[model samples]
Target: VLVGRDIGTVVIPEAPIKFYIDAAPEERARRRYHELKKQGKHVPYEQVLADILRRDRIDSERDLSPLRAAEDAVRIDNTGQSAAETLAQALAILRAKFG
Candidate 1:
């Protein structure tokens, strides 16, 4: 699982698998821009892109809890997939692994 700061330190029950999901900076920026616009918020694409880039840099370079996948974790790049497609893929993997 891809965990943010809050859940990273906790130990959960044993599971057979875990994965980290990520997308390219440009793709993430575009998605964020569209989501904000859909919510009737005014934000430019350039601003969203800049914010994503900045956050990406900070996440990668953070001294503690730097954003990275565990050695055994599968990494999924969801840049091109629609949300439903991504969820379907993830569910398929879970079923295959845990059934």
Candidate 2:
């Protein structure tokens, strides 16, 4: 299970199963804020949000290996879900695809 922004799109375009997991920007910012706090990093929530947006824009706009979902990738929107829930959804997709 390789995890990267461009794994499915660039590194391994022929992979059988690819999941593009996403969430709202605000939710992502909240999660990042908590993560940074857990690591003892002192950063404001608004600043974290701005950084996220800026990084997203840069990633998507970059000429090489831009961030994008592969054409055949399974898109998952886990805006308000826990990690376990997201895993369950991915597992469900695998089961349905292989069963």
Clashing pairs in 1: none
Q: Per-candidate TM vs. native?
A: 0.81, 0.97
Candidate 1, lDDT over the whole model: 0.75
Q: Summarize candidate 2's per-residue lDDT along 1-99 as a digit string, tens digits.
A: 999999999899999999999999999999999999999998999999999999999999999999999999999999999999999999999999998
Clashing residue pairs found in predicted model 2: none
The TM-score between candidate 2 and the true structure equals 0.97
Could you tell me the lDDT of residue 56 within candidate 2?
Answer: 97
lDDT of 1 by residue, 26-54 (tens): 89989999899999999999999999889
Clashes of each: 0, 0
Q: In terms of TM-score, how similar is model 1 to the real structure?
A: 0.81
Q: Give the worst 10-residue stretch by lDDT in candidate 2.
A: 9-18
Off by over 4 Å in 2: none
